[model samples]
Target: MTTAPGSTRNETAAIGDGLRGNAEELLRELAGPAARLRDDQWVAIEALVVDKRRALVVQRTGWGKSAVYFIAAKLLRARGRGPTVIVSPLLALMRNQVAAARRAGVVAATINSGNVTEWDEIHRQVASGAVDVLLVSPERLNNPDFRDQVLPRLAADAGLVVIDEAHCVSDWGHDFRPDYRRIRTLIADLGTDVPVLATTATANDRVVTDVAGQIGTDTLVLRGSLDRESLHLSVVRFDDAVERTTWLSGHLDELPGSGIVYTLTVAGAHDLADVLTSHGHRVAAYTGQTDPAEREMLETALLDNEVKALIATSALGMGFDKPDLGFVVHVGAPSSPISYYQQVGRAGRATERAEVVLLPGPEDTRIWSYFASVAFPREHVVRSVLEALDYERPQSTAALEPLVELNRSRLDMVLKVLDVDGAVRRVRGGWLATGQPWTYDADRYERLDAARTAEQQAMLDYQQTTGCRMEFLRRQLDDPALIGAAPGSGACGRCDSCTGIHRDTTVDTEAVAATRARLDRPGFDLAARKQWPTGMAKLGISLSGKITEGAETGRVLGRLNSLGWGRRLRPVLDGPDAPVPDEVVQACIPVLREWDWTVRPTAVLALESPDHPVLTTSLAERLADIGRLRNLGTLYLRPDHPPVSAVNSAHRVAALYDSWEVPDLSRTDGPILLVDTLTDSGWTFTVAAWTLRRAGAPAVLPFALATPT
Candidate 1:
C-alpha cells in the first residue's frame, strides 16, 4: 500500500502488505489481472474501511469511482462491517453498479421500482448479512413504508454509506433532483462511526463545497483533472433544424464505432432516430418514456455494439458504461456546459480517441428558456400547496393537483422541498403536513435560478468561444487547476479551433432538401382523452369514468414543441391579432389527406379562442373552403368567461364547463371537425368535443395546429 505523503517508514511498515494485497486482488477482479489501484482510490478505500472517515470524490467519469466503493465494501465486509448502503439516482446506474460489484466478488443487491417482488428478498439478504452492498434509488429514501419502517434500521447498522451522483444532493448542481435532498437527513441519522462516501463526475467547485457541507464536517474532497485527452471537440453551427438533422444523417457514419447522439427533447430523439434510420443508420431512440425492459435492451445493444447509436435524451446518461464508445453528437446544445460535459463524458472513456460534436441550432435558446421557465415556482404557488395540506390526513400528489394550480411534476418538486424543510412528511397513503413553520427561501431559489440562467449563458459563450473548447468547459466548472494554467497553454490541440480540421460543416443541398421534405411532412397523432381525470366532481364538473362519445383519434399539423412545423405554427397560434398564416393552412392539406378517420367530417366547428380568435376562425374557414365542407361557425363563449390556464384535466374541465354553447343543436348533425389554435393538457379539446357530442353531433374530429407535449 502506498503510504500518505510524509508518512514515517515505521508507520508504512505497520500498515503491512495484507491490506494492500486484498485491495489489489479486488482491483484485479474488477479491472482485470494487470489492474492496480490509483493512489486516490486506495486512499478513499482506506479512509472508509480503516480510518472510517467521510470522503467526497469529485472525479471525472470512468475514473474508477465505483471501484473505490466496491473494494471498500469488500474490505469492510471481511472485517464484519454491515453492508454498504448506496443512494443511487437511476435504475440504469444501479444496474451497472451492481454488476460492477459482483465482478469484485461483492454481493450487491438493489431495491428499486423495477423489482417490488424482489425487494423483500433483498431486504432479507441485507438483514442476514449476506449482502455486501445495497443499491437504492434516492427517491426510495422518501418511500412511506421504507422511511417509516426500514430506514432507521438501515441507518443504524450500515457500515458505510455511498451517495453516488452526489452532486444531486446540492440544489446548485446542474441536474438538481428533489429526492436527493433526503440524503442529508439520511446521513445525519447514521451512527457517528459509520463512514460515508459521496461521488460525482460533474460537480463544480461550488457543488463540491455544498455537497461536502451536507455530507458533514471535515469531509475530504478529492477532485481530479477534468481534461479528456481522448475527446476531439467541435461545435457546428446550423441555421435551422433541417440543416442540422441533414448534417447528422450525412455524417453520422464517419464517426468512429457506436456511441450516443443526444437530443434535447424526447420528441427530438424519436424524430432524429427516425430520420437516421430512414437514411440507413442503425439507431434507436431512448428516453425517460422508454419502457424499463426496452431501456435494458437498448443499453445492452449499445454495450455489445449491436447498434451504431442510441439517439437519446439525458435519461441514458450517467453510470451507463461503454468502454469503446467512439462519439457523442448533440443535435442541440444542452442548457448548460456542466450538463453538456456530463453527457459528453460518456464517450471516449476507455479509448484513446473519440469524437465529440455539437450541432447548435437556432431553437436551442428557445428550448433552454422553456426549461428555465419551470424553475422554482412563485411564492404563491408554494404557499398554496402548503395551505392545501391537511395535518390530519395525507394527500397524494394527484389529489393535491386539483387543489393547487401547480402541475404534478412542479408540485412534487415543491412537496419535496417542503419535506426537507420539515413542513411536511411522507407517510402511509401519501403526504401530510407537519404543521411546522416554514419560510420560503425566496432569495436562495432566485439565486439558483439566476445561476441556471448564467449557466445557459456560459454554454452560449462556450459555443461562440474561439479558444480551446475543453479549457473553456474546465474553466466553467471552476476547476482551479485548469484556471491557473497559462493562457492558451491548456489548449487541447484536438478541437476544431486548434486542429483546423472541420468535418463537413455544410450539408449537401440534396441532403438539405430531403431533410426539409421530411420536416415539412407535418402530421402527429392526437389521441382522444379516454377517461376524465380523477376528482373532477369536487371541482363542480360531473365528468367521470370513460367517455361514452367524444372525438375519434384525431390529427394535428404538429406538436407545439416539434422541431418541424411547430417552429412555424407556434407564432401563428401564440401571436396576437394576425390570421393563421398561409403556410400553415397549406400544410394542413397533406395532414388531411393522410388522416385515416373512422367517419369523414361533413361540417366544421371552431372552438372560441379569446386570445387568438382571428387565427382560429381563419384556420377553420380556410380548411372548410379547401375540404368542401360546411363551415358551421364557432362555439360561442359565455360573456365575461375569459380563457383560464388550467394545467390539469380536472381544472381545465371545470374552467370550460358550460362555458361554450352551440348556437343551434338542430344544425349540428353528422361528424363535425373541431378546430382550435392549440391544445395543452388536451383538456380543452376533450371538453370542447364532449360539448359538441352532447349537442347531437354524431362524431367529432379534433384538429389543431399545435399540441404541446
Candidate 2:
C-alpha cells in the first residue's frame, strides 16, 4: 500500500493512531454524549478508510449507518483524499445528512431540484475542496447538464462513493425507483481505487443479493439483527371505514408521542388530517402534492414535536429521521410487508415502549389494485416508445408523447429501460435510437409482477398472522438469527397477539356520530377548465386558448377517495345502472341549497352516460322537480365515442369535439343544470358546457356525485 507523501514509518504509525482518535471524537460529536462506535460500524468504516474496498451495510434503521460514512469522510479528508459523494433518494434524507455533517464539523452541500440557484456556488465549493461531502438525488444523475458536464469529473475524483437507501437500485427491492438504476453505470465508471459504500435498512435477502452483485466485485456484506427492542407491534382490523375513522379519532391522543399517520392515497391523507383537525388535534397533511416549502416545514414540525402527527402518504417514507418518534400508525396497509416494516421502523428508534399499530381497512386490496396498474408498462407501450425514436434526430419526451399513447412518466421509464439495454441513448436534445438489438424480458417482468402480488398477499397474511409480528417480519427478510430464537417460539413477547395488551377497541358514540356527520356533509368545487390542453390541434381538436363561456364552478358531494361519505358514495357510483339512490339524492339537497351560483339554473340538461343513464336521468329529474325548474330533454352522445377517461386529455377532447348535441330544450335561453356520473380530466364537462352554451343556453352548472383523483 502506498503511504501519504512526507511521512516516515513511525510517523505513519502515529498517523494511524491519530486517525482512530479522530474517528472516535467525531462519533461522539455526531451521536452525542457517551456515544461509542459499534464493532460492525468500525468494521465497515475500516473496510472503506483502510482497505479502500466496497461495502454493503444492511442493518435496521437507527443503526448508525450514517456514522460510518461521515466519520470515514472526515478521516479521508485529513489524509488528503477528495470529497465523498453520497447519492441519496429523498430531499428529507439529504437535509438530515447535511445537518448531521455540520454537527460533526464537516462541510457539506447539496444539489437538487430545490436548490437550483445555489448550484454554481456549490460547484465552486466542490472545486475548492472546501466541501467534505456532497449529497445529490438519483434523478439528478440523469440531468443533461449534470450528466454531460459534472458527473464524469466527480466519478473519477471522488474519494468515497455512498449509495444510501441502496436497495432501490435493485429491481427486486420494494421501492424500485427507475432513476436509481442509473447508478449501475455510475458505479461501472468509477475508479477502482475509490471506495464505495451502499447502505439500506429494509432490504430482504433477494434485494441484498441483487444490490451487492450490481455494486461491485468482492463487496463486504454486513448484515445485522433486525430486532427493534423499543417497538410494541400490533394490528387492529376494522369491519368498515366508519369504525376505522372512529377508532383513530377516539384514540389518536392516547398514542405515546408525536409520530406519523400514513395513508394509501393523497385524498385519504387530506381527509383523515381534516377529521383529526376538526376534533382539535394539532396535525397537518403531507403528501407528494404538498409544496416543497410546506413539506420542509412539516418535517421540521414533526422533528420538533410541535404537532402531534403529520398525516401523509408514501412520499414521506424512506430516510426521514426522527429518533424520538413515539408511534407510527397506518390508516391503511401498504401493499408489501417490506414497505410496512420500513414505515413502522421509523418509530421506537430512540424510545422505550413506542407503539406501532396497523389499522387495516377493508379497502386496502382495492387501493393496491389501483396502484398495481402502473407497476410496469405493457409490451406494446415499450415497443411504441422505441419505434418513435429516430437514430439521427433526438426527440424530446413531449414531442414523442404526440406519437405514442403513454403518459410522460411511463414513457420516461421505458426510455430509461431502453437506455440501460443499449437500445436508446439520451443526447443533447432528447432521446435517440441506438439501432441496437434489444429484447423485452417477458419472463423477468412476469416474475416481478408476480413478486409484487405475492408481497401484497404477504401483507394481508401479516395482518392475520398468529405468530410473533416482529419475528414474522424478520423471517420475511430471511434473517439468519431466526433459527436461534427457538422453533415455534419466535414471538417477540411485546406484540398484541403475544401479550394480550391491545388498543381499546371501543368507539365513542358521539365521535362516531361526529365523524359520520362530517363525511355526510357535502361540498367540493368543480373548478371549470379554463384553458385547453396544449397540442390539442394535433389530435384533431382545433379549440384552443382560454374558454370564456363554460360551465360555472360547481359542486360534488365528495371525492371518491375521501374518508367522509366516500365509503357510501363509491358503491353508488360503481354499482349497476339504476335510478339515483334515495340517500345520495338526500345528500345532494344540502349541496344544492348551499350553492351560490351567479345565475340560478332554471332548466335541467343531463349529459349522456351510456354506463349510468338511469342515474343521470333520475338525478336530473329529481333536481328539476325539487327546484321547480323545467326538465329540458337530455343531450345525446354520438355513436362510437369511448369513455372520457379511457385516454389522455388530447384524445378525450378529440373524441368529444362534436360528439354531443342538445336534441330539444324547452327553455333554450335560461341557465341549465348539467348532470353526470363522475368527472376525471374535466375535459368532458368542458366540451359539454361549450356545446350547451353554443346551443343558446345562457349558463351551465355542472354537478356530479363524485370526482376521482
Candidate 3:
C-alpha cells in the first residue's frame, strides 16, 4: 500500500501495537498494493496470523481477500516455518496474488498450466524453501507427484492453508464446483497441521457450515451481514421485452459515472451492450470470452471514466479495482441471489449510494399439464456423487465416470467442473480433469443442467416469494451470517424503498385485501389445509377427494356421511366404522379440495359456516387459500368445449364460484396464500383477489412475500 516516506513503517507499527506486535508488523512490511489496508482489514489479518485460528474474512467483492492470505504468509514465514500454501480458485486472482507477493518481497510462485516452463523456478522455490506461499488451484492438489513430492516438503514447513471463495463446497453456492470435495483430502494428505482459513464474500449458513465441514476448519464462524447500506435495490415489472428495453434505455445514463449491467447470459451482455450503445451510452460487453486486452480495456475505461458502464455478465469485476461504480442493472433473472449479490456488488465499491434494478415480467399462468413431469436430479446427483467418490483414495473424475449409468462423458464433464468459474485448474495428469474424457450414454449427461432445473425452479419460486428478499436469500444461503435488518427497506435512504419510485402500491391492491389477510389467520379450515400432503403420495392416497365429472355433490356428501361431518360440522373426526378417523378425513378435506381430479371440474368449491365456533378463527386462512388457487385447467360443462388455449376456458373457470355449496363468506376475507406456487400466473392473483373482494370479504392482502425477483 502507498504511504508517505515512512507511513508504511508507521502504519505497520501502529497495527503491530494494535495486535500486541504479533503478525501485523510482518504483514505491513510486505504490503504492496497502492490501495492501503483499512483498520478492519488489519484486525482480520491479526485474527488470522495472531490468534492462529482458521479465519474467514468475509467482505464485499474487491475488498482484497487475497491480501489477507499474502499477509498471513509473511508471518508464517517469519516463524522460521515454511511458507503457507493458498489454494485459490481463479487464475486471474492467482496471477494477481503472485505478483503482489513478489512485489512485497515475499517468495510467491504459482503452478498454473499457463507457464509450463516455470516448473524449474517453481521447483527451485519449493526446494530452496524461499517461498512464503505457493499459490495453487484445487486441481493442483490432486496431482500425485506434486502431493508426493513438492507438497510434502512444503507441508513440513506449512503453517497455514487457505481456501479462497470457500462456498463452492456447498450446493447452494452460485457455482458449485465438484472438484472442491478433494480439497479436504488434499489438506489431510499434506500433513500441514495448520489452521485452515476459508473465506468468501457471499455465503449463507449452509455454505459456511458446508465449507467448514469440507475444509476441516474449527467451529469458529466468520460471518458478515448481507446488508450493503450503500446499495439500493428495486424491481420493475414488465410483460413486454420491447417495453423493458425502452425503459432500460431511459436509465442508460444513470448516476453519470461508471457502473455495471449484469445479465443472466453471455448473449444478454452483448445485446444489452448493443442496446445501450444505440441509446448513446458508452458501454462495453465482457463475457467469459472477453480477451485480456478487452478486459483491460473495460477495466481501464471504467477507471478512466471513458465508458459510463460495463455491460457484462458477473465475470467483469474480478482482479480489477474501480472504487466508484455508480450503479448496476439486471436485464434478466440471476441464476441465484448469490450470483445476483456478487454481480451487483460491483457497484457502490466506493461505499457511495448506488442503485440496482431487477425487472420481472408479470404473466397469467395456464398449466400445460406437463409441468408435473419436470425432472429433478437433486437426490440422484447427490447419491451418485457420494457413491462415486473414492472415499479412501482421491475422488478421481476418470475412475468414477464409468461407474455411473448416466451419460458418462457429460457426467465426467460436469463432475470435473470447478466453482466460481475457472477457480479449479486441471492438473496435467490428475484423474479428475486431465485423464481421458469418458464416453457413454450422451443423453443423460447432455441434460445435466436440465436435472438441476428443478433446483432452479425452486430458486425461481424463492425469488418470487413476497416476504422479505433478504430473509429468503438468508434461508437459501443457510448462513446465519445474513440475519439482520431486512435488505432494501430504505433505511439507508439510497434503496428504492426509500426513494419510493418503485414502491409496490399493487401489493394490497384488492379492495378487501385486509379481509383476505384475516382469512389467512389460523383456524380449523387453515389447519385442514396444512394436513394435506403434497401430490407425491401413492395414487389413491394422493387423491384428496373424488370429483364428480362436472360436480362434487355426491362425493362431499359421501365423505361427510362417512365421517358424520354432515351429522354436525362441529369438529367431527370420530367415526366408529371409518377406516380413517373422522378427524383424519376432516383434516384432509382442505387439502383434498386442492387435489387435481379426473372430473371436468376436479375441485369442488365448498365453504363452511365461517361464524360457527369451529370455523370462526380459521375463516380468513381458507378464503386466502381459495383466492390463491390457480384456475387449474377449466372443466368443460358444455358437451362442446373450446380448445385448451381458449378464452372460454378462462371464462368458465372464473364463473365456477357461482355453483359452490355453503360458501364461507368470512373465509373470503383473507390474504391469498396459495399464489406462491403459481409462477406463470402472478397476475391471476389480481384477478382472483378482485373477484373475491366483489364476493364480499374484509380485505385482500396480496403480498408475494418479497423476494430477490
**Per-candidate total of colliding backbone pairs:** 0, 0, 38
Clashes of 2: 0
Highest TM-score model number: 1
Candidate 3: residue 557 lDDT (0-100): 15
Q: What alpha-carbon RMSD in Å does predicted model 1 have with respect to the real structure?
A: 2.3
Clashing residue pairs in candidate 1, if any? none
- For candidate 2, report its TM-score: 0.95
Q: What is the C-alpha RMSD of each candidate to the true structure, in Å?
A: 2.3, 2.6, 19.8
> Which lDDT value does model 2 have at 249?
80
Distance from true location, Cα of 282 in model 3, Å: 3.2
Q: Is candidate 1 or candidate 3 better by TM-score?
A: 1
Candidate 2, 1-709: lDDT as tens digits: 3354687768756766676777889999999979988888877887788778899999999999999999999988887899999999999999999999999998999999789999989988888888899998898888777887778878977989999999899899999888888888888889888899999988988999999999887899999888888989999988777778888888889998899999999989988888889889999999999998899999999999999999999999899999999999999999998988888989988898789999998888989998888766878878888887999999888667656776667778888778877898887899999999988899999999999999999999999987888988888887766756674466788998788777778888887888888766787788889977566666767777888878889888788888777887888878898899888888899898889998788888788887888989999999899898888857888666555443555656677888875666544667888888888778788889988888787899989888875
**How much is the lDDT of residue 11 in candidate 1?**
77
Computed on alpha carbons, the lDDT of every model, listed in order, comes to 0.86, 0.86, 0.51
Off by over 4 Å in 1: 1-13, 574-576
